[model samples]
Target: MHSSPRIRTSVAATVLALAVVAPTAAMAMPTAPKAPVEAKKSTQNYKGLPSGVSKKKTLVIGLDGAAAAQINEKNTPNLAALVKNGMLAKSNLYANPMAPTVSGAGWSTIATGVWPDKHKVPDNSFANPNYAQYPDYLTRLEIARAQSSTLVVGTWSPIPQKVFGEKTDLRLAGGNDAGTTAKTVDYLKNGNPDSTFVHLDEIDGAGHSSGSSSAAYAKAHATADAQIGQILAAVDERKAKKSEDWMVVITADHGHTPGGGHGGSSTGERATFVIAQGKGIEAGSVRHDVKISDIAPTVLKHQGVRIEDEWQLDGQAAGTIKADDFDSLRPHLKTGVDETKPGTTTTGWTTTAPSGWSIDNSAMPAGGVTEWQGWSFATDEFWTNVDLNQGRETSVHNRNVFAVADSDEWDDKAHAAGQFDSTLISPSYKVRGGKTATLSFASNYRIDGPQSGEVFVSFDGGEPRLLKSYDKNFNGVETISIDVPKKAKKAKVSFRYTGTNSAFWTVDQVSLKK
Candidate 1:
């Protein structure tokens, strides 16, 4: 029997399926409960409504692990239509450097309008989540205004039933896209739900079985687009029959790697998009700055729910919705370096290698290549799992940068580990206002035998001061921040990789900001 395929619950909440991979061991999987359940009766229902001529309702479609680059006019017609008439943005997901990027964490962030730190869901296990402190938006809606009808459905039972853990007016579980669409259509036509959420699982599944850029994944994307069209059509039909004014929003929890695997801090894994189509949204407008956590507050605001400061959410309403608080939010990296290509050189970086460090573009995972010994930057295709070369295709760590020692090299020999005793120094840059400079960068490293990786900074060419260090094993793309010396007029950073190495050190998007 095949093992159960790894399933990522919707990073966002919805009743639709976002299962990226089909269950491998279908027999081992429990049968999905066949019907919908009624929500618990509320003791008190808040009757507050927005004062307007037309009633307002919300519909959110959560497409799990969908990438913006893959969606377009021809492939995802429905999504395209929404974009043509709405606002779209390449939104960023707040990442936890220490945790694996999975469904539980992503979904919780989406539901609560906060990052993983607030929701406290770091992995798929969903242990010790701080739901009481940061409950899902639906739960907030149910509690604040119990009279409003809410619907939540998803094929992934864990997400709908456990992760979000909200009791809506109507909740459905376990169904294919066709079934989900039909049920959603019936509910929209017959019942008037103030808020609705739908999830889709097929595209993510295809991304797992076949690579995200593969034909199978493309087909799955098309299928999801068609299904979304059906759901929108049903909403329109409902509008035709009634005086319902609906605001439709769509978003994804995460993006998949080119090789069809995720859970890293690579660009592809963290990149996601948001689409808001409503009366206020600007048609065909594109935004670069947005976040997945912004969805909950936006939806609540549109529904006339007053946002309370006591909730302590991390997101503000984005897109067309006016939000004055978002101005305080700014990019962590204002200035930096890129060294992920062949023959790349920094004007100020000085290298100290007994064997000399040079820029090259190849690596030998199975064995060491003599030609790659002096290579400066790590090649994008140098993953330990070489079979999944495509994984290096998209959002690769700045196209893969490297810091290695003279003896360090990737080898095919199972036990042939070497030490990397080399250092690369950065150019001197002014730290404005004496102490305003702070440095941050993404680094990925692997070590096998002994010793470790270390980073140091020399202020005005003073004694090297240690900043941070790492031991053996894998440290995925991590953002490390350090404070520069206030007294130093110039700062030179250094990366030291000196230890028995099974894996090399790679850094990218190095930034020094005031």
Candidate 2:
């Protein structure tokens, strides 16, 4: 139904990670409503598919790590079959840019239909050692899916498992034998969940390990395809006997590069397809643009959840695309691009200005200097000396920007523009006389509301140059640039300092290209 993937140098490049946090007392116990498994036994061979509410059931098969490169009609006939009978395309699901593209963030967003910060399920580590937890919005649905209403089955990480444990009866646990398929079967025959989410992990794991095209990767695809066939068998069994408007959506959580990594900069890293089919949906539907964030929102709409206001997402209800609603979250691109690898690592070249600038992790003792081009702030706390803040003020600058992001941790301040700025601070960039370059950096400003940030440039000590500006009133536009004439080569671009410095933008890919 969607795809996800990212940056940086040896400095660990500020990964949007899931940090460990103890679960609250409420999360320690499971949230599913206790009921005998026998009560669901009498249902037909349909998961999330009730007897009469054909339109009530929605199934999302999350093909984690599946990308555009691995998809083929011949390789995945089962998915192709669904598309042939229904409509499917790319979709956006998350509103925040740093919603960690990994399994934890993407799946949690899918299950909850809310931003990672809102759901509070960052990754596996939060709940488990390997995975994280940030809380989840899918707890009740997991119950609904197990009852006569919905069923969720897939290869999921411990991240989601911790937030909504034992909520569904047909859960097949990810990383197990026939994990994705077994749960689909359980729902089809025993639970009949009205809304089901099926997932596959091997493909993504293989892609992360060996790229998406390696032999191991190919085998994973073929195997997952075979599994899709099995799932289709179960879904088709009901479609054949009844005039039901069953729908099947097949898509990947995120894509991978050719060398076993994703994120950062590359179209290949963002490239994944969506294929859908069923009643009330169009067949042979081909869409050109869809972000991975749109999948869960679409599914939730199909399930009759008022997702519009509950979730602050960038995705749209793609279910009606066949009916011609094309205005949805277009796409949010990676700020940096690495010309070498399939995934984005670095974009341009950058260095600290007025050399010998103080490089300290005072703000985040654990986190190093988070310098960027324009913005550097924190949310609830500043990393002034490696200490957390509930929103503190600290400032130091030598014409650099900085930021810190907990990708899967989609909490409050994480969505604003700056967790660091208290007042207007300006950054400065200068170009020699014959240089034309670009300045790009990864920042978690969290300024989705009314706020503004500006970029200032200087040339030969002349007047200042303002490359671009951001405010609570910032409009939607990717790859913004303010071209400096050749005479402006002596000009530089960066953010000026004013005040409010709780975080730093870990600067990278700062380049002055020809």
Candidate 3:
């Protein structure tokens, strides 16, 4: 995760700098930041393993805080080999923006094949975690087959307790990376567990101690490569002796900042990669992007474990890679809003000129700015002011680009009075043979007071019918389901933003599915 080891600077910078910087006697605090509200942890217990077994074995290697950018043949030869022989070498799989890019949440996403909504791990502390309800894949495997052997080895002690859970039969949680590697190799050679998970923390430690771009980080990665090479050697020997098929998957929980901190949504922090090498995986078959949740299902599928719908898994098997299929409401419509500059044509979708929607890249009133190189707009808020020297960027919705309808001109005033209305309509969709449809999009809105705005749907040149109404403070993604009336064969959607006094509405990634 991004925010850690609070490094305070006495000199001033911006709102974010103040947010993270420890207070000093010489400085007058800009504003006492509100403490983050954590979600309540659940205490539900799950059932034991049902009787079943898969033919193939599985191994998962998790590298904490490893940035894809830092990976190279010269620095990490063993990892390079795995990538060269696996599906991930040519693919671009990103960790979904489910929660902050932190170890506990990212690893939970990897282990459970679900987002934070299901696992409920928001940070590293594992505070109020709901892992009992959403157990790890190892635990799921145990549930499927009570007699199956499972092993977990990690230098990070919390990973075994917080991520792998209680199902594993052999857990070597504490020790240095080398010691952990020795244990994993020994277990691979002798214990022969059906499913295994290996966690390495030194690379991340190096990133935090030395910058991610530094030589020290590179050396740490190299040392880890040597250790992994030894473990792989054991796996090869086991495969040769037993003639057993195995699937090996490798991935990282999150990426580190250049300065070695994480827990934010910056591109660097969100950077993650996955590699699948073994039975049924395509060699040199590259995928453009994959989610971390996909790893669990992919591994299970390879192990011959049946993934049922009742499990409510968010991932699919890695065997088949397909283009966008409009099974969900979002795949039908082109992107009406994306991370693009104001006045520029959005990449996938189009809108009418009369539409009041425009992108806003300037610093928000909350003191967040999109620090893209092309962001030339001047920010005027006192707390929002910050130098671009450290290359830190902030966004209102954790992104640089967003569609906005603001009440005042960019540089004019603090707030505006009276109504400021805007509508962003979608390109027409021919949903002739489709059933009920759903619309989803991410948005952040602010008003002087009270709720204001509505989402509407129109059927084939008919009047717009209300879909959903905005009545309170909302700052995240919203999905609305609409049943297509029998009379309509085609439909169009629009978000009507209406507000009085000071207000602004920002939207992105609008999609529809039937």
Candidate 4:
């Protein structure tokens, strides 16, 4: 019997996937963050606007789960416009392979200019509840303020609220309408201090849960773009009233996998954007090889504050511009799944309530709705498995046992039921902006029993639009156009199953073309 595939859990499965990476020897990563740049206290105890007719101001805007696949030029006109006008830094890092690559770790890296290991805030919940320094979601504001007069606004996380203190300017709201964009405006307008930051998380949330190509994903991009537009407008509004030197920095904590995950090993996670405008940013700038942690120091430099080199950060001021023109493109690196190791496959559909498991074609397992949405089982004794490369994760039902292997090839014993189960595998993919594309592939659903499967497409990885579903049609495996809209950054297709009972299916070698 053919062996089953390797199943994994969502980073979120880690309860704070953002903070954990599968532990490994600490790589001799990058540099450390310097001490917080100190602002020269106002000499006069005067209340109100003073200074040589206003000094330049610095601002930092962070987007969680923001990346090329999640939001691109075509879908996000405002952000795209910002890129066009400012410096665009396409490649950057937030965490190491050891880091879970989850939100907290990723954002913290951007915030403290340090890694998970250095910051000691690895996952969502760390050892012994310590509400001491830098807070987490659900904490109070005063907790985060004892050190600095920081202002933080967040959507799903309470860390910002805790870090900023009770008097801290922190707000929690919906992802859309007055989202991260609005919080930023308030910070810039009121708490316009030497250091200020606003976090946007919709992009990543939509992309990670929904495929990057789903309509939900598209909506997220559009919403974020609209909010970004407002942010730009706010900046401009301030500019109209009086010259406020504001340098806007935008970048993602980390990218996600085609399967809507980042914790797993994939080239996508290492991919993020670093676009900046105004003040020391230099217009029409384009830099490469910038990491998330580097933004802090870059902001410090722009404000003309000297930072102590004690923090030990990993990023450097990057790029070259029309005003920039200083940096170069970041290294193009893409890591593929280790095929030689235990892998997932949709070789057949489980039927007759196959004691093993059954899942949908979208790559979800058939067994027990993936407790917390995991990819594979911890053990293989009783679970039927399906695996694939970067798309919606395949699922398994009846598969309950769990086991850990150092490699990809799984060696476990499993029995089959008398009847056939039903299932289909669907995975998400990505495409560049302004392109008409095709997703072509070859798949086989072992069970011929009253079943129909097709490859469906979604805009930003939202819903599936039937590209072609079949009971037993393998279209010679040539190539087909996916017909993506003008504005598509992510694309996804799945072998949809319209059959009774749950079963497994097999699909391979899928690609997208313009």
Candidate 5:
């Protein structure tokens, strides 16, 4: 687990005390539920503007510290309506090293379309932010389309003062949540803004004052939900008068611990969500691949701004995201076995590989943790819950179900065999002879003790050649160019991991393109 710097304040101390006294209910994991039915794709031609609508605009509402699991039709009718009409995506955040699950890092990642490692705002102090390189989405819109108007209204001063750039048309700092909502509502109803962002901080304050499981937290959500309803009403009134298309996005920066406070690796603290309704989005869809970083790109894409490759953004547009082969295994993922930290009832971790892919554990460990004995497919929720604060939470880039080789968890149980040795083999792909092919995959490799992660490529069923070796920490997508043999017609890729009471390696979205 990543370490958080001490917050020097009386409130911080009080929150810490509350955390110890009232542990979150999530600490007691529930029995594994049945696999969820796959979401159906919309068949409607959800492209281009609707009839009579000429311009495309967007509104992003940031509800600080609101947990997705807590929202429902009873408590948050307005937000629940949006979820029924659009899409709700549950996601997690990083802790410590990458950045604490605090407002500074969370909001920055949402605005900049990148993680804290790139934005450099780890804590609330906002020391040395790299907005010059990765500016907020609204700032990027101004640079890309100067004629477009942008507005940012927030209760949190740092958001409008530091996170967003000065190029935005209007930046307002509301003294409180009511003030922020008033300013935003006025703009949406009266002003002709192309893109707008509103941040509400009352919910987070409520969480800090009272535990997330407390009635005060629920009341805070109700208050914010009413405020959001006002904002949505303004949008509707504007849409009724003008022939315009509006996209609304509601999201949270981070979640509070059950007993309040954050900046830790607990499941509740790491929780974040995205609820979006707009053109091209499937109604009532639930997805797990969306990240907080995706908010910026999603807004940019909705407003018809061309995302430049030079920007090096880490997020893809939410509506445009297509599920990878590994993501398709969600419905097939099995409940936990031989692991009891979060209980053996969690519905994650599957040793079954997708069609055309295979896992080889012949070299073999005999009696390790059943779930992680080999390359296993898993969701972030299950894998991170196994052991908190071990840096698994930092794998924020990989979304949905990804392949993991966790010897650390596997070694928890007594084993009758040698060290963990497993290989994940990819299906063969056709390649042009003498041409360079790119092998792209998202990889997060952490080393502890003695461990090795190697990537190999074989051409035309010939001897495999070493493509890359991982001996240190790596945490992003890797694109390697491989020169095909003069007479080679096909290629297959493989990821082999070996460890002895060491850390782990996770790989996902593997593809080979010429």
Candidate 6:
């Protein structure tokens, strides 16, 4: 598990200084801004079978220890070609307590469609895995569709022996990357498999022998690319003869450090990516929200499998993923003014609300970090890179841009006065009189020092009523039901946070339903 950094004197001094400032009267509620015209939703299709395809098939390729940032056209031409024809999505992995950025935890998450907290594969030892409760997707598919054929070949023995299940039609352990690629190519060319998974390990071996920055690592990429090219050729030949639709997805388990090691929370070690090309998937598109766990569900989706809600899978199909209003702020994000760790060029953390939302900083202090003076919308890359190894990596459930109230990062710079306090107001929603409405949102709250997060609701301009108050660590989607009083027509929700050099609170994918 990662440990918190020691609190600096500047923050402690600021806390003492703020203790003397007298409290002022409450300010009036600010007027909500006009909602912008809703942009036309993209016509890009991510579901259903393509026009000519009668049969659906899936192929998943795993490249061990390959970081998304290191892949380029020069070294990995075939993988780059897949990106050119498909979608390239970058995502990070959890570290330490959740699971170290190791192959055991990473591959388990991809195979089971859940996080380490559920799968219980905390390290390479593979102790007390919850596979019986949450089996590999292939095994689940076998149970759902008895007639479908499945195959799995892995260069790493543990993957085939322990990760995949006994129910798979065929599971083989190839001694090395070349052997694994050859087996996969032979099967695609001669066999009639409905779904296949292949794991290549030479790239990871190279990283372990020579650092990721070494020439040997680059050579490994070239070799792996060639192997992937051969596999793609086999797939093309099979497609031409069988007249089938194939959705191919390529991804990595975890990334490597510059010096060739992993199992840490550094940006390099935690980095992972997804590249997919096939029916219903947009061509030449890029995404920042897809995660490693998405591969299992995406494969099941392409193969016409119904995902049950009771499974409690942590991933959604890549094609079916949609962006929320907060994600639309990506282009408008600004470079950091006080956060020097992520550098001055990173465009992230904007205080400007998306459309109908507003941030109330009327009770906030004079100076903190400009990026986090109030509730700000930010991307994962920008926020997590500020300081590594802080539980921020566990914010895996949140996608794209989300709301953040970070007193920890804000205290990194010199502030004039006061503790961190901000409120995020939501757009007014239509509510039925005398009926119950549910407010649902994904929240991740981490507390280091003193901090409090409270939720309030007001109806028809009535006084705000408390719904929930958080003073401890909480993570997951929260659903709170509110009884609408008689004759109520409209309701507005608010989130207020107060902290003194504590951790952070992130909110995303908020909605209200009756």
Top-scoring candidate (lDDT)? 5
Q: Tens digit of lDDT per residue, candidate 5, span 300-392?
A: 988878787778889999877778888889988887778767666668889999988999999966988999988999999899888888888
Q: Would you list the C-alpha lDDT of every candidate in the order shown?
A: 0.58, 0.45, 0.58, 0.44, 0.82, 0.79
Give the per-residue lDDT of model 3 (tens digit) for 413-455.
3333334445666667666444788787656565554436677
Per-residue lDDT for 328-394 in model 4, tens only?
Answer: 1112211112221223431111111112222342432333322112122232211222232321121
For residues 65-116, what per-residue lDDT tens digits would candidate 6 score against the true structure?
8866667898888998899899999988888657888888989999989999
* Clash count, predicted structure 6: 0
For residue 137, give model 1's deviation from the true position in Å: 0.8
CA error at residue 481 for candidate 6, angstroms: 3.0
Cα lDDT for residue 70, model 2? 63
1-514: candidate 2 lDDT, tens digit per residue: 1232211111112221122334555355343343456545335444333432334666777777786556668776666666667665553222223343455555665555444554554443444321123222233443333343544444444433443344333333444428547656655655445666666766766777788668878778878889878876776676433644555677775577788865432344544566766556667766643344456666656665555332345455665422111111112212221112212332222212223122222232222222222222221111222222211111111011233222111121223343333122223355544444665432223232333355565565566666665443221212434556567545444443222332222222233443
Clashes of each: 19, 120, 13, 106, 3, 0
What's the TM-score of every candidate structure? 0.57, 0.52, 0.65, 0.48, 0.89, 0.87
Local error of candidate 4 at residue 175 (angstroms): 7.7
How does candidate 6 score on lDDT? Answer: 0.79
Q: Write the per-residue lDDT of candidate 1 for residues 406-487, one digit (tens) a residue.
A: 2333333242344334566666656643455567554656444565677787777699888878865443344445566556
How far out, in Å, is residue 398 in model 5? 0.9
Ranking by TM-score: 5, 6, 3, 1, 2, 4
